[model samples]
Target: MTANPVYEFTEREQHILKLLVDHYIEQGTPVGSRTLSRLPGIDISAASVRNVMGDLEHMGLLKSPHTSSGRVPTSAAFRVFVDKLLDVKPPEKGTIEHIRTLLDPSLNDQALVKIASNYLSNFTRMAGMVTVPRREEKPLQQVEFLPLSDQRVLVILIISDDDVQNRIIHVQRNYSKDELAEFARELNEVYLGRPLAEVRDRMRKDLERTREDMGNSMQRMIDVAGQVFGPDEAEDNEDSMLMAGESNLLGHADLGDVSKLRDLFNAFQQKRDIFHLLERCVSADGVQIFIGRESGYDALGECSVVTAPYEINGKLLGVLGVVGPKRMSYAQVIPVVDVTSKLLSAALNMRN
Candidate 1:
């Protein structure tokens, strides 16, 4: 399924290839020259059509499956179709409004992400996915420290009215309630309203410069702060993506192989590989499409992944997209993904 380099096609070659690919996509079967010859816009005899199809097969754009005399467009053909031939169909105005209504701005970010995933699946009849927004981007609203027994402290981080995170960190020694309160007060004064990522970096620098000069109590407080403010390993280990309609892929004929479906479902359940794939698209601008074998995962070798990064105020948050057979309607699916990303971004922006 590795891609072949693009080859120059004559006007007749492009026309015949487009007709064959379109028919195969619609019918989900090999296309014969006889069928292609009769298709609209193809004013060629069956013999002439077969000759052109032979040329296409020689160029690695089409292949004849052993079970059938007809031909199927190879991945290379799809690549050329999307890149040079496909005319993308934009969603209608009503479709835009419908997506907007579904992605209501009043809903919280998590709820919005779920709705987006579900909508993509429902609309495309394919597996849909959205990455959970990064936790460190939220602005800090407040911080609190409560002393616990055996040299441990409960650190509470308030990110917003609705978002709060709790972490328990072990300290070198226990401190009085008043000392803990003082430490919280000083940290809040310096780091309040900053993003958690920024606060973590600044805290690291502060600890480095002040460690030798500060008293033991202050040094201990800084040590506890370092532990508390560092990246959450637990959160990192948890799945950062939300997926919907993975079972929908079961209905796609091309992906019906039991072993292939099993591996695909397992990849969905494990999520690490897919999440990393989406992460690569985070830095890409606008929509990114990965055809068969382009995704670099064996389970996805028969699938096409269409993704677009969603953001707020021009800052990227995460990626969202659909996964389906390579024969998917790129003309429709492309705009659907593009518009979903925009609507999701708008909904999140309303929250901020």
Candidate 2:
């Protein structure tokens, strides 16, 4: 199928492509020439339809899995259909009201993400996922330091509302309680209400310019801060990907391969590869679709992902998506993801 370049499609070819893609997504079955001949608005004979289908197959847009089975649109067909022919259906009023009712203004952002994921699963009958917003370092409200035995100090960073991060730092020499308390006070005063990434950078430069008499103490503080606020510390936290309805993947015929299904679900349980896929969608605006093999994971080669990046006040918070078979209806899923992202942003803005 990959050997030949795709030829420019004629009007009849476009009609066949649209009908095959539409019917295939609905039935998960291949389309026969007889079916195309009888389709409304397609005034063509079965012989004509067969010839066109053959040309499309030669163009690498359609394939015949078996001699008896009819032709089916390939992933290439889907890309062209979505990019050129597919029409998005606006979300129903009932679904909009349902989303509005569920996305209460008072609910926290995390709660809203879960709600969105659940709604996507229920509506699409597919595994739903949402990723929490990631920051290199959170905005600090306060910081505390406590000394421990064996030249170690415990550092507590209070970030966001009610969120705390803990780190342990080793020191070169012993320090009294007074020095620890003074350092804590200095840190809080210097970097309060700012992201730790900026704090770390500012402190690093300031440490280099401190008075010679106070150099040793400042250098020790810098070392401790370095340990607690390393660039990669954020990656060590618990996984931020939230998922629901992974069980729904079992219901799709495209995932009928039990081993592949197991691998897909296991990917969900691990949450790393799933995030890696969704992470690519974060920079993309609006709803995005990844068809079979486009996800770059063999476990997902038979599956499709429809995702969109959601924001709060124009800031990209994270990504949300539906995972189903490659035979998914993009016309339907696109609007759901689009509307959910809007509702989620509105809900978060209300909370803020």
- Highest-lDDT candidate: 1
Query: Clash totals for all models, in order?
Result: 0, 0
Residue pairs with backbone overlap in model 1 = none
Candidate with the greatest TM-score versus the true structure: 1
Off by over 4 Å in 1: 1-4, 213-217, 231-234
Evaluate all candidate structures by whole-model CA lDDT and list the values in order: 0.88, 0.81
Q: What is the TM-score of each predicted model, taking all chains together? A: 0.94, 0.89
Lowest summed lDDT over 10 consecutive residues: which window, candidate 2? 230-239
Give candidate 2's TM-score.
Answer: 0.89
On residues 74-171, what C-alpha lDDT tens digit does candidate 1 reach at each position? 98888888888888887999999999999998888889999999999999999999997766777788889999999999999898766788988898
Tens-digit lDDT track for model 2 on 1-352? Answer: 0232355889989988999889888888779999888888888899999999999998889998775569888878888888788988898999898998998978776788899999999889998899875554356789888999899998888875535778888877667788888888878888897876788778667656646646676777776766666543545213588888988878888789879988888788888888888888888978888877788887787888999988766767789999998888788898988999888888977765
